[model samples]
Target chain A: MSAFNAQRITAMQWLSRQLLNQDVAGRYFDPLIEPLNPRWALGRMIATVERIEDETHDTRTFVLRPPRRWRGFLAGQHVTLALDINGVRHHRTFSLACAPETWQREGLIRITIKRTPEGLVTPWMHKNLYRGGALEISEAFGNFLLPDVEAPLLYIAGGSGITPILSHLESLACREYTAPITLIYCIRSAQDQIGAQQLEQLQHKLPLLNCQIIRADQGEGQPPRLLQASDIDSIKNIQARHCYLCGPTGLMAVATTLLETRDVPEEQVFQTFFAPLTNPLTDTAGGAVTLMRSNRELTVDSGQSLLEAAESAGLSPRFGCRMGICHQCSCRKTTGTVVNRNTGHVSGPGEETIQLCVSVPQGPVSLDL
Target chain B: MKTLNETQLQRLETGLDAIREDVVSDLGERDARYIRRIIRLQRSLEVAGRILIPLSLTPVGFVAGTASLSLAKIIENMEIGHNVMHGQYDWMNDPALYSQDYEWDTACDSNSWRRTHNYEHHTYTNIIGKDRDYGYGLLRLSNDTPWRWRNLFQFADYVGLSVLFQWGVGLHELEYEKLLSGEISLRDKGGFLKEFFRKGGRQFFKDYVFFPLLTFPVAGKVLLGNLSANLARNLWASTIIFCGHFTEQAATFHEADCENESKGQWYYRQLTGSSNFTGGRWLHLLSGHLSYQIEHHLFPDIPAHRYPEMAPRVQALCKDLGIPYNTGSFGRQYATVVKRILRFSLPERLTRQAA
Candidate 1:
């Protein structure tokens, strides 16, 4: 990060914006530049895979060298990785499993991915992506991050959820933070436990760090043991410790309830869900919809999709295959919740692209149209 | 071919729907891989062309550079731009391939192309006064339109349209007929004209000014090379497009006859209004898989590469349903297109009607 290099990057950024004013420069230049170096692009943030390590049978850690323009992230933040498998680019988000100091020192970040057997992108990455492959990645995002105060902490991680927790622990160790930290790492089996070496290293570095590996599977014919009230009550001064949970939805729910019963403040308990929750189909009725572009408003029933609502209001949003097979009708939902009728997935109450054909408004919604 | 009854048309609808469902469900890595590979190949050819064009000191360099650049432009326009803008790969959700976001190397802006070609033409295929794509309101492809004094010289018009096909398409949305008839004023088209100039102007400057000026020492050679390449792409794209729709066997419908059409009837109309040219893989790729124009008209959002596999199933279903499946060798189809253009250029009574 020399002054000269910083100045050069600033100049390049300005030039890129000017050239991409209408995407005319990207349209012409990207093709030529990509063939020479896939990591170089005006519009996209490209990263090259510097190293790959197997952490478990289904999990691997990818060390990536992000392009020069990447603003480094906090320890627990995640990024969306866009992998071109076969011919299609598939996007999946994963937490950055490294401390920010690592990136600052080595210009590298790591993402630990666990392959889902039936998944599309992870399996392809496991089999096809080599050491030198390039991937498109979004800038680091997510609210699950380490707190600034040196407060006692409790971390509950299930299976691959250890990724972000590991990052937090390493960051604490890097800064020589001596606050009492308790990590209850849960896995289905011993073989499933990831970042074992890192946890051991963190335990040595931070003397007060208490690491607990909990295996849910007890033995033959026994039901799996999940997070219990005892798990939280056993932690020293449970009410005082700031609890951070990342795991299966059921486990997170149980942990939250247990902490709530112990009089832990709601703001003190932070959690992130790894799996997409299936939205309940109820409550998707009689919502006011606003088309932001045309300044049109209408009320829609549960059965009517946003596409139908827009069409009924005489707004001709581009659409094809009204069944939601084609994504031509996708537009940015600027505010409020909408449920995807096709998959029953509820969208976050932030700006995100949703297919108008199949998305039913769960509440008052504003669309980019 | 005999016209299909209502029951037969329903069967046609079910059969084609099944074919489309199969391809749509099966679209994954393979289809994605195919498009990306084609894009890579196209970009590689373009890079080679741009570098070689300036080194046009030798005759071989000039010819090869022009040919490569022309091929690259053809692939970008026809295979990538046209098909992507049709929302074919919109399912992938890749920003580069997204229909609404993709602007092409061609003069025709993507948004206008989607409106005029995808919405209007595909929705109202060959319905004489409805689908402007029938003859682009230029050539007399069918006797459905009254023969005018200008019909005698439409062959020349066709040639001129082919030579400047990109510009012609760029201006297609302006609807010159409406402006001339005083139905719509040029003032109403101020926004469209501005967009057309912005997109078309960028393309003009890139080929005529920017690239030529970049190769300052051999500026004239680069300028002529780009011009030749654009001409080659224009002629090739226009010819392939003509073979798809204006061929002798392709049928035309009336707007009155197309009112409140059912899905089955819509499928039937698409079948009759389009023609396909048989060729090798290269020809099909070069044509942007428009060689399966019937399938394209029916399923405009399906990946064009998948059209090759879908074509035979569609043809078989059409055959069983007693619907006409218009297809022939490339040479035969192009010849029929030429014949249709020349024959309709004369008065209907003077030239024999195509059966």
Candidate 2:
């Protein structure tokens, strides 16, 4: 923490980068160090699981103790957790459910994950990951940040979406900010609600905090009570408050429309999506794809990304993140047009690098796979 | 030899495709853990070897150090480096195991290996004048090519080639035949030569200069240990590779005959042109699973460890299709490889007359 120590650390980092480049150093040292301590890595940020707490039957909270050099995240930011299960590395982004102050003071963070029965990673994490397990985590990212101004805050969360909102509330409580705050927590049933105790503590800490736990599934055969305009209209000065939304697409869409009809300023609205947005090309029939390296040709449907198509065709191409955040799956395309599912940008009919996870061929395409 | 009709070829293709799909889908944590464990074991051996060679006070210490180091280098080159560079573990998405990003502890650069070995040799298997891997342009292995007088003394060249196999592979992509024939000038190979030297220089420095100097008091001993280890690794790797393709039963194809081959025909060519050496797990592991040379040629991108399991299925298919599945004991295979080399040392007419 001292100036001299800081300068020395920077100089050492520079020297190590020059003398022991990551590719070379990592390949040699990682295998050696990993056996002694799985958390130790030369080029990756690895965190050890401190504790595991089950918040609900299907939801669990993992308290992680990251390494010293891990740059902390904003209160509502998310980090990508890389888990090597069954020998293949799988990546998923989860919101940092703990306050930033907690990370700075305790050097620990928490991520609350909801188990999806049909999903690959969540169920594995729930069943296998244990205390003292090491996980690779990327630095905190996402734009669901707190506003600098002293404005009334409105947070709307649906089911597991309460993670980032919990961070925001806890962060605000740590700062002793007493500005008016309203939170609408929606879940299917009472047992499905997460952070109930934390919400109570937060409400007690901030006098103006008003919390509402809404249940969408009333009972069998009863129509589901979704987010209605009355939920927003009940809040005082709802139009003037800065809104943060995190939830399923349907709930977020309804909330956004309600806010828009109320004439809330668009800039004041902040939202984050837990899942990758649906690609526009999902319904179109794909074209022929030629894997030039293997001298194989297959037809891939537009519903699947090139990476998925390749894997299903019994060809394994290099890939990472699988969500277009990492450029690991980028391969050169020799000919044909494609659309980037992330940005919906069409590429020219020329040689160019395209991310296999997000690229869908618009027509007959040839790749250097 | 048996030739298949169109329907039979299609059936063969479908059968092989099913086998590949079964293994590809089953790839997961087990395969990942196996490779990682091998890497760890290799590095541990290397570290122990480096330390023991310099610090030991007896000849046993030196021998142990040299053997350990030699085994480490062999594993790094065969099981780990060769298979990883062939994109066997590419699905893991681990940066260290990535084919494009990996650099092996040998004189040969990974890029050159990927080009010449992965793309060229693999694509053109044992096609004469196409796959440079067949005999590595040093010795005659089959009668497909015209005999040259220089081949008479190629038995000695084989010994020299085995002793310095790493360097031979490092210089393989340069096409020395073209250089000798004035088809390509030294300037045309400037970039390749630079990469070859840079990679080769680092390897030499590590084994001979840097590690030896670390223990200056016994620098000579350490240098000798490193030299012996590298030589042992070179010979082992060369022998394993030769037994894969140059055995007596392994066939060779002409470019004209292989042109426009279908998937089934291509698989058939690979099956006939490569021979497998039966061995225990350790022998197979040390050879980087190249012992299952027939399966490796057919499914080059699959993890080599899986080849043991795949070999039985492939052999069954070969039997069903009535195609030759060449295999034998390691000693028998090596003897046959030597026989093929010696038999081809003379002109085809003279060898046939002698037979």
Candidate 3:
């Protein structure tokens, strides 16, 4: 009882400090500690797999019962699920699915995972989880949040990239903040959509959200139907607005290419690519040039980064700072000529020049790679 | 031209000529197409006051300045000299030049920068073999090269003096030219006598004595304007320059390592070669886009003012390219410099470098 009373006092004092805007995290944590250290916070799994939906062969959704005393996260925060597999520790990040209000009233949370080929964590998650299974979780982290910008928002997601968007939707639902939202969640097929029921629930509950799940594999849509470069044609008036992208690296690459083709300033392009980048410099904003010494090729692309196409074709090259400052990424043209978009610097000398680290591939450009 | 020593002047001209040639060749002759425009822009800003004085003649001055004390006569002595090089008069119909000074309300665009700043300095940054910013000794801003023996004393000299200049602006200037002459030049004797005192004198009285003492603060707003402007420029411009190449984190590449030199290599050298300071709006706006040193290095002509707008794209690109784009506020950048100094000074053999 005495310990309980002291705990109550400490909680109240902590609440007071929060209201007073004191540095709480710094007051407790070792400031010099390396960021990569395991961050373990005690969180209980209250509810488990209410139901499962097989969106594809490898993806599923599991509604969870969080601890009654557990605090909910703001929309868009990610929680790390820790699982002890054969006494070895493993953790995987999952986006929260429950609305903050649901945490208050229902004391529940939801998370979805999709199995990627050869990925250890997701494949295991798909096969083993059971109803009401306890899950250890880490504190919520990540900066994917809605800004105060009152402008109507457009969200683009590819594959499993919908996780954070789902969290954002739940948060908006909890806050009762009315803002128009358009989500173009691209999937391989109609059956590939993972959170259809939850999305339908959001669409029904909040009339302000618009969700469009593009099915590329079905081949039933109009031109640029597969979420290609022309998908951003409708956002011409969105000058100075924000763009949030989350998806497989290739999808992000395509989306970025589409945005750049529309002449959207590089500043407005918000992208996050979560897959392996076969060619890291695909859709560059600009830096270091790639040069082709002998092959018959052309290099100039306002659409996709020049370096990306080359690397995509399995060319090994050396480059850096695709943003444009570092010359380490420079290449030389033993024969052809190229132009730089950033400083308007061009150096195609058919003899020895370089490809900018960031310039997207335009035509059939040759490279020394 | 007569005022400068024959041989010394020739060397300076030769140095600049070679740099210009590299700029044209390295950048793919794009400057060839835009050379006329850049030159015109440079000339106009150089004679700004001469023409402006005819229109508004009053002791109605006091605008804050952007020049730095460590930079020597940057405001007092070298203002007009740089103006002559930059061409501020081009602002008549040009919004680009006007926006260059937009961050600091008291500041105005002057010409010296188009050639001296925007073109040469930015494209070249501070590679000792190529960049003018690379002075001898510890005057190094980049770490791509290893420290030479001579730099041992120079480093001590710079740290001591640079720290002092960071405190007292005026006192630092009077002594800076002599101090810099030792390492940055093959022949250090000329700039102090001919270039600094005489050349610096002509521009000083016109900018400081005539502009500040005679014409400024007269309208009260002008005085407030000049002081604020000067303060803004000093804090913004100097801090930006410092963050980009001066911080201890910037590279000091060796003459040998710069092999297989190409434009992209140069770009990477400059991009990874500089440091970014973590600071406030005063630091961000006044210092140009230096807070985004990594971004600016990746895209020099994008304008320092536009860097904030480019941060996301830069971040995304850095991610896509798998390169580390270093940045932080002033405090963070400073802390980085402290760490850099420690690492740079450590005995080399004790360190196990990566293969």
Candidate 4:
């Protein structure tokens, strides 16, 4: 097992398995029956709205409107955002805030997008999209939403994990539900938080609802004590509640441990990983370019990475998290070498040049795409 | 009486009446005591077909092996469960004298399947007014061609995947229905309806897709053998039941007149409606008493176990009386049923010549 793969398995566990699927159908007809379905191209983009809330520096939450006919999804469920940067199309999955039924009823869909240091699709969307713009979104998909069990909910969210958790609260609150509900949302510094006003409105609206917004940016308030198990104990019984948490990489792991140590049923606590993979090309002053995706070789330009060279040669490869973290772009190097910009180390020394998101092929390479 | 042109078959009504009387007279014999023995032999052929099949174990890395094994299990179970439940072994006892198929709730009592199925489907065979197996949704499940539908302009039964599910909806309801005529206590009604829907959904899916998908072979592996076997169970299960009522030669009358249809007329209907599949006595036992559906439908009270001997006696009686008695090997009889379907589904001029 690769260190990149998560140890915990699930009912539909195949979704999280990092697979490098190239658009390989154009070459030969597939005669054998396989469960692996291919990625379809983004056809005409339906007209949509992008309501933005400006935070500091370039980060913000872009509330995207899904096509009206496209309804029915749980919060934390993300759509793969289709982008055409420099005429190159790619997809990225983002979690939607609020329950599917809410957007279904209100004629709106909301996505809380944060601008990374160099987000390819995010920067493009923040600049171009306005009300009634073409918002190219994929079909709503994901199984990470809160399960419809009878357990009381124990919500532990960090960063954007709060989106699905908030959707869960909104759904349960509407039924005037009899089940127990608790929410813990963690954010970096108070200003980066967007949904505090919505949470405040929900607190005053529902009688049995409890909301806690914890800040991790300890300046004057000690970041509200980092949402421990004891904090949830003060609110309601934890034994009979379903816990759903989503957020930063470190907080997600710690929350998973806290709940397990607290003896919450493993099935009851759910986590949605926000760590996505996308590639941002940087100049490598081409010594020699090796594209190791099949024996399919390509030249790496001083300006473009191995992916760009392949795309320029009319080979459109699939990628989700262009960052090396998501492993979506990892290809095998039958032979050759590549340099990783993040670690500044050459991986193809004794091995082959794998598509390490931000890596460029150093020499002649063969890839098993 | 009109005689079929192609064969030695004669519509000898008087001869049929005499043969019917002769069958009852011969009933004093050990094998013929119960009127249903002839049909039991047919079911026995189907019963014997279910041999001890070896299980195939699959490797863990792939899901291929597990699916095929499950399919084998489905084939075996569907045949055994259906035949055993149907009381194809006619000697089995029924506690009451009743026929029921009103989607009812009787959680209070549980011993009603024997009466509803063992008595009704066996006695009435494919009579829509009585046989629980008969379904009337857009797609009809059973084989018997309804006189009313035949007289009508449009098709009541559709074919293919989409229509198969809708027609099968009623068959699935059979698993939960209380089908009894006792006092409807509130508790019984409540318990029955609640459990019915909860469990009913599974049966609906199982029949519609799970069963079919399970038997579907994975790639590279040829499945026509297993396919043949699975289909054998299915075709055997429904066809035997259908043969007793759907054959072009089968007779029907208004339910009001079922009681008045002369004993010979009833026998004639059973003879024409049902068929005999000759050869392989061992095949008869394993497959349950399906091949002898004609004899079983004629006498529902007879135990199916005795049909092997009774079938030969019935055939002889028909021969002696100079009346046409339908008897064909399994393959031929299967072809006949298929022909009857074509006769029903196709245009009149292209299919069976109307009487």
Candidate 5:
């Protein structure tokens, strides 16, 4: 409150408490004047799943409406979404598989998620995520975008790598782009190709779009259905096009090698992986250690975060916003040094509050959990 | 640039890093308890003060009610609001104290404050043309700011700003200057205006219209009490903030001078750009631990309660490095701030001695 009219403010608050009820008034009024929803005060952007659509046997597209606090994102950007299941919050990055235009017009963005057999979050999302479910989303970020130049484009997508490419195609189709574009999507079989309907719709809308699906298991005729350098060489004007490859690591490597052999410049070929990037700290020398927290004692891998090690040991800890920003995973570091994965800043060897998600154990570190 | 040798820069970096690591390691349950307790105390005082307002027909009731209300507002704005919004105590993971979600009780929208204060002000510190808090584009705080004829009325503007600080803050990000220069149209500011009106309306109705009408026949007494308490809070807030920032010893910088600023140079800038004042524990709390502004600037995200403990160590480091640690008594620092304000009220060209 400013010096101007301070008294009336006090009386008004008093009256509000006496009349409308304090919590009720605050709930109804504060959000009107504030950006965050007071009810879900998790210090992160919250989005509600408005609808869900299964794209394939293993892939589903979730349409989410984020709160007004969200600043929105560009086409082909990925967002880190977190969901708490059984009190343990898990976070993963998913590409926005819908056009940015849709978000502006209808206030919705979609992410097509393919469940990895070993993944914790995706499998749960496939089973438990329903319409009207609320999940925490980070602001969208990533630089894998179409170049401004009107060059002919060749996109090679293997398995779930087609998500971001789908977003680019949808956005471009909406913008009435004139550049010739070709997508060769490889899956185990035709049944596993996600967003087939959407791709067909986009192809029908754009005159310059050419999409083809390659099913490895359906190669019953002349040749094997693996992407080869000769296969890319056969495409008209393949040498003049910019190549974008995304998918499993093996496919990416093969495509990159093929593209490079054809004299494609490094900058002309772009790639993005949805899998977790290998932690650089894992290469650092750290002694194997025991983590003692609450009633659990478990052996932890050197150079791995206490949170990850704890999860590996089957411990469920309360957490929110897995990034260090939220600090929901902060626990007492009572006895040893740890390196912050985000900043590479080392902690002092003493009792201190350390964010569990980002702090990699330097040695045998003891956490209060 | 202050021309420090490589050895000196390295030494400063090491010292500052050690201090940060030590303090961060020291954070524990006690710090969490301190902030949580402060929130509870502030809410309790506010509730008590508001409840006491209707009894203002009696002299003692008026005194107690206004005083309690002012105390609550002070704690909320300074300790609870400012500190929480700084990302301090964010490690607690308590939803109520989460920096991004916390909305302050002021005229300024919390999002705007985060942009202007948390991101820009803290990142740039006292760098000229960058740090908006350096006179807030109204006054000429440094000689680097070209003397404009309009600055002659800055003293009046500053006074008006203090009286309605929250309003000034709310309007800070609107860029009225650009709007006046015809760079942007009303249509461009439509969204901003809508937000401003929404937030400003709530503040106005609560303070001026709603409560006064609630008191009925004795509405005048309640209105007067609320007015006095607000004025008291504004005056104190202005005084403490000015003392920490504008005292004679606080240095200002050119943006060019801060280019490629090393971690050591960053620490040096924070030390030179902020002034501190001595006070008791209560005064420290009331000031939102801003009394140790040097410490606050050095470690903006650390809990303010730790500033007192970190101050002596930082001061010692400054002494060893031969850097001037600017600090003084509350009276002396505040007097120096007022002197600067008055001195810079007129254009420097006009204020120059006869040559």
Candidate 6:
């Protein structure tokens, strides 16, 4: 660690200790630096929802005010929001749908979320969230922003992937940035498009912006072109402009292939997938599994991670991060074929360690629990 | 240590039940706010205290700096570190305040402390053989502990323990007794020893070397000031903690007696096993709110600030139920604790008649 950082840490520790002391400052600020929390660690920042606005039928934008210690975020960075359901903490990552300028001016941050049918966090958020509700948020992170570039921009967004793109656009519009920009927003239906109103307003506000709507649903009038290579051919001067892609798995896959075929330089194409980019596993019907050392046999439900199945079977497996970041939950898969949800790699049947939090059993598997 | 009849025991159980229900319901934002505030004050005091210690050229600067640093250390260990490590503020959902992860600014490793103090001491409070904290495997605090010849030096041992209480706490989990007896091996203690030295080394460097070295011109005086401040904190912590369990009237139990213990019966044991010291708010902060030790034992996870409010209600119930509520002034309790230590140092046969 740098000397400056070490000194700062020591100072912060001392300051937190003073705040934790039995003085008026400690009393009034106790809710923030609770005695049970260590001062030196980067714990979750608590944010209270100031307001909520419906962006679409299934998507809502939540405006939150974080604690005083929260450092400002970049325009297109994503933050992980956490909530507890049935005594378990669940986390979901969403891009900052509001511009950084808005945060600086109003001390407000926003995340626009679209509900997914099988998503536990989003469905719960939609059903339960209200004004003034509190949620835990991580520091804004991710490198999905418009880098310092002189070229024109080609932004392609599908479904709720529009959140971060909208943040960039809003930031650009706020600056009245002169570089020409084009946005091709593809959605299942026109009504399902997120930030539709904001896009309309931005066209008038940012004179250099060119917005295009592509509805790929079967009932749409424009022959329902589902983002094929032909769509790439339709955009004029696609090679010269810097391209950015973010969306559902299908759109991203087709867009990526189309871009690759058109020979757009790899560095010029910046893509960030909000949804999983891992290859789809055809066999998700996980069957009965055996824990060799523990002498326990349990059924693994289709599509359930090994950790979840183990927990359901009255077994506690040590875990941390749960996002495959901290390898605390890695365990020996003595004999089994399991698919890694994060990397999409199928593990061979042998004695090898795998992260239980993100590894799904393909069939009857034996794990050295 | 008077034995109670069945009717009296039942009344005691009923009284404890009422107190628990009342306090459990009273847990709310107010209690949450109280702990949060204490943590803030502790941080501020610590920062200010550490910053002041280097400028100890003048007599007043030295005295004031040492006092501030000592006070900061005292509150950090007692109020913030001890209580928070007990899972007291885990309900807050603030990760920084999580009991499971909080590492205090002491020589003792947090994970080791949880093993020795949280899981062992709290779960088996005052149990003669099971709880290592029952006299910390040194002085025999009660008659239930068999007298040993080595215990005859407890008076001197107490003084050493006081001057270096953090070191003692750091080595609490070493189980050197087991190692010496051939029950465990050096290989077994390797991990623990490594962790101990790592934490203890950092503490030694900060207090003895780093800050003192910074005051190169007046190094001797500043070093002495830091040493004096640490010694003061150590003496204070040992005194308060020792008084909590070793006061004259506190009871110790046989592990057999605790089998299938009911909630009420468990509460009764905690009430009898731990003693409290009475003092003002400042005293409470310095003691880490351990002045209400009985209340703390009963509700280990509850914020310590709530104990004062709980004490009066608990005391009234104890009165109505005819149960003993062991408490007194700090001096009185400390004296009784010394007497217990000295008395227990001798064989039971000699002291039995007086008892």
* Model number with the top DockQ: 2
Worst 10 residues of 2 chain B by lDDT: B1-10
State interface RMSD in Å for all models: 5.7, 3.3, 25.3, 32.5, 9.2, 7.8
How do the residues A199-251 of candidate 3 rate in per-residue lDDT, one tens digit apiece?
Answer: 99889877988777788775655444578544566554655445678888767
What is the Cα-based lDDT of residue B212 in candidate 2? 78
Model 2, residue B72: distance off in Å is: 0.8
> What DockQ would candidate 1 receive versus the native complex?
0.27
- Candidate 4's C-alpha runs over 4 A off are A1-47, A54-59, A68-71, A218-225, A232-235, A276-316, A323-368, B1-355
Deviation (Å) of A73 in candidate 3 = 1.8
Worst 10 residues of 2 chain A by lDDT: A15-24
Consecutive 10-residue window with the lowest summed lDDT within model 6 chain A: A19-28
| Candidate 2 lDDT by residue in tens digits, B99-153 | 8777887889888999899999999999899999988877888777779999999
Top model by lDDT, which number? 2
- For residues B2-52, what per-residue lDDT tens digits would candidate 3 score against the true structure? 122344334433443343344323432232223223333323332343233
User: For residues A252-308, what per-residue lDDT tens digits would candidate 6 score against the true structure?
Assistant: 778878887888888888777655425434467686789975578998877778888
TM-score of each: 0.84, 0.91, 0.33, 0.36, 0.53, 0.67
Q: What is the lDDT of residue B271 in candidate 5?
A: 86
Deviating ranges (above 4 Å) for candidate 5: A1-318, A321-369, B349-355
DockQ, ranked from best to worst: 2, 1, 6, 5, 3, 4
lDDT of 5 by residue, A227-282 (tens): 77766876787777888888987899899998888887888898886675355466
Comparing to the true complex, what docking class would candidate 1 get?
Answer: acceptable
**Fnat across every predicted model, in order:** 0.33, 0.67, 0.00, 0.00, 0.00, 0.02
> How many backbone collisions does model 5 have?
4
Candidates arranged by lDDT, highest first: 2, 1, 6, 5, 4, 3
List model 2 lDDT by residue over A223-266, tens digit each.
98888989999988877899999999889989999999999999
Q: Positional deviation of B197 in candidate 1, in angstroms?
A: 1.2
Alpha-carbon deviation at A191 in model 1, angstroms? 4.5
- The residue-by-residue lDDT of candidate 1 on A1-369, one tens digit each, is 699998887776554333232343464566557767877875687899999999999999999999999988997888877776555555677899999998999999999999989877788888888898888888887888888888999999998888988888889989998779999988999899899888888889999998878888999999987778777777888877888999887778788888888999898888874553344345557489988645678898876789888878745466544555436578898999988876778889999999997899988999986
lDDT (tens digit, per residue) of candidate 4 on B130-226: 5554432222322334333442332333223112332243233343333333334446456445544443443333333443445454322214223
